[model samples]
Target chain A: MRGRLRRGLLLLVLVGYAAIVVLAAWRHEIRPGWLDAPGAVARGLLAWAGIPPGVAVFTADSASAAEAKIVDLCLEVRVVEADGRVVRLHPDAGERCPAPQPRIWVKGEEIWLDRSAVSLRAAVAARRQELRRGQSARATRLLAEALAAHFRARAHAEGLAPERYALLWAESRVDTNTGERSERDVALMRWGPVGEGDLRVSWRPDASLLESHWPALETP
Target chain B: MSDGSSSYTGQGVLERWLLGPVSLQVMVLNRIVLGGVLFLHAASRAFELPRLYGEAGATWSPAYRAWVDAVLAPDLAAPLLALVAALAELSPEMREVVVIGLYTVLLGSSLAFASGLFTRGAGVVAVVLHMLFVTIHPFAHYGWASLVSPLVLYVVLSRAGDHLSIDAWRRRRRGLAPLPAEAPAWPMRLLQIHIAAMYFHTGFARIDDPLWLEGQALFEALARTLFTRFTFELHVWSPLLVLLTWAVFLLEPLAAIFLWVPRLRTLCALALIAMHVVLEILTNVGWWNFIMIAGLLAFLPPPWVARALPGPVPASR
Candidate 1:
């Protein structure tokens, strides 16, 4: 009887362990994805609180431009890849920004970028080409708002639709025809690979007229 | 050399109790398995499920960057370390190299310790090995690895391997008698307790995560599969998964204690192994879960597998 009891207790315990392992098979999905909902909330909160990803511009004239047209070129841009790999701009985004890379790296392969790291000029130029290429009123306005944000905090203004468009543009590439944004969120979750962390960019100002644009990535 | 003779004194007393047929079987079986699992996990990395994983990892994975940093510096230290781990695990063309060279060396060392041959030397090797190959694979590591680290250190430090191992086999072969002394009852205790911590820690840690609570973690994993997208095809599994998730959380620690008693440990070990097999089918967590189960299987009481083998009387008998 004692032996039987021991066996019975043992059987119970084994059954319990079996139950746990079988259930744990799905443990990774039982919770909200790490940083999924929270990361979005953090960005939104920062925006509402008027806290951006902390951009700074160098002032030559040394004037406080509340409306000082500033195009803080990203000196160092970090792009967070879908699989969590980060592609970084080499040579710093300063004097010579090494060409953009496709935020991807393979183990045995030589490392190269997919595209030259996107510069502020590139981002703006991309925006311009996108705007001209796309010809949607919505597209134009989004590009314009992004341009305005580069100028000064006070000068930055947006139409509701355009602001949404700007956010979309920041998120993914815009389609030329349907005006639809790429499903980057879906892409991220689908391929949502994360390893590389943080991409950096340097913004270069367009011209002297926009010299108030002090369009340079300077850290304060 | 001393003449080999049984130190077991009381003929009737030994005959009546542990020196009987059953007890001897347990000792031998335990020795073989513990050695085998250690060697196999390290040796199999070159091919099979784990190889596919290594290839996928070698792909432009964004997720493995941190792991890459840990294992793959361009320099020798990191790369060599990774290579050693890899060669031990994968080298398919050299399967024999790993299986025989590496596995035999380590298992032989473990056997020496177990059989009281060179107890301290074998203990040191075991501790060094478990530390090097076990804990640092953060991406692939799970709760069980850390739990066993200290216990293994203790086993080596205190000389548990001095008992029923190849060391004993050699001693008997060298005209020395088999050891009447036994492996401490405590390694059984240590394993049981350690596993309890492992299950409880994992189960509890996962409880707060929204994925575990909602049972979405598994669904999400399933969603990733080409055959079954969790959204449509895998959704059928969603309803039942929540209850199943909760059940797993409760059972893991309980299974650890089951090791103390004989019958229960066997069933539990089987259950754990089966669970790993099923998980292996469902997800691509690599070989971590399998290796962990293999390690835990070492703790199974000896008599169960030995029943199949020809064996002599039990130790106490």
Candidate 2:
């Protein structure tokens, strides 16, 4: 092909791509819409060709939406031991401890204490209710205090008191329909055991803080 | 007697600029690299076919439907979802078998593409299977995957297999000896344009974000040590983190434009590679950082590539 012809064709294709980007951005929001269509086209072609459907491909928007759904439903809780043998706070029966621990972590002098799974569930539920009520900041504070108490109680039960420990919170969501999983760090809180019913602590909800983690509860 | 050829001065500016002959070495390299990357990508998922794509997989009919409804237009979604629903009706065992078969085709075709054997046919099959994989699971999609999709399609239409390939070697063996080192530049140029647009858009999007503006994005990113390969304590390096943030903002747009400048092209490529390397080190973004760097390789001049890596050097036009 002549260079001029090729360049003209190239120009046409780029303009078309640009148009797609503009349309996608205008309709959906900021994401590059041009990128979304190929997978959709491929899936549509398969369906048209009567081929069996295959694995899923995510667009930015769809993945984010699915992520939001999962976050509302799943929480990943772990307790780190002093010797560095972390335990899964809620492991299904017959499930082995994952070879790799969750990326969500807390720094500073650390200790692990095991507590009642049932109590943690109740506390998480209470926090969820507060979140649904649009009291995200307050709920995060409460959750932090509850986690600190849970650790202190465990220390008391074991007849050992650690000078300090940190709580790592990671949230995960699984799609009910497809079993797709999405997870993110929720928060990390540092707490030091003090006198009875007293604790010194520093807590923050991820880096974006409570607003991003509890987007649903953000003030309109 | 009038000669057929016209004088160079008589040619229009567009003709002069767009019609200039360039080497196809970069295009051929791009073809091989993409084919290899995609083959490994497909092969890696072969064993997990049943769990990730079969009817019994997490992204079954309902999940596929939700995804289509969310991203695709109604006209496109209806047919696609119906097709998914039909496919989802297959028995678990049958779906598993189909998934395995599809991946096998993808692996073979991708290898063929990389080797430049049956180039056109292999390219077609590879692209088709790649798209199916994308449709299989909503959660599996990444930006790099989409970028590769168009690129593979475009290269399929070019003379990407003309050299540095099994096809070339076979032709030489068959008496079409010493294939020309330079092919047309249209395909590689198109790829360059696409890459520039991507960089521009990415940088443009970040221009307004408070986190990016305040140079706190990296600080926030640093705190998420779960994504890092090794522990990196950066509390005392806050100022440097802030400097790196602004550097990213400057480098992206600079790379996008200066990449076309022959004098600055090499530097731009290096800068982009460095940026991606940092991202790879600091975060678990999967194949994204790698693919983006690979995509940028399309911008490299053939002579530079020939000198830098082992391959057939470009022939003068």
* Fraction of native contacts under 8 Å reproduced by each candidate: 0.00, 0.00
Which is the leading candidate under TM-score? 2
DockQ, per model, reads 0.02, 0.05
Model 2 spans with C-alpha error above 4 angstroms: A1-220, B1-11, B16-19, B55-57, B61-83, B315-317
Q: Give the Cα lDDT of each candidate.
A: 0.38, 0.58
Stretches > 4 Å off in candidate 1 = A1-220, B1-31, B46-120, B133-148, B154-164, B222-233, B253-277, B280-310, B313-317
Kindly list the per-residue Cα lDDT of model 2 for residues A1-220, writing each as its tens digit.
4854765675566556545643443212445555667767776687678653322333322344433342331223444344544455433321121224432121111122224324444334434535544334335445555555555545544655455455544444445566556544445565554455333456654434434543322221
Chain B alone, TM-score of each model?
0.54, 0.85
- A37 Cα displacement, candidate 2 (Å): 11
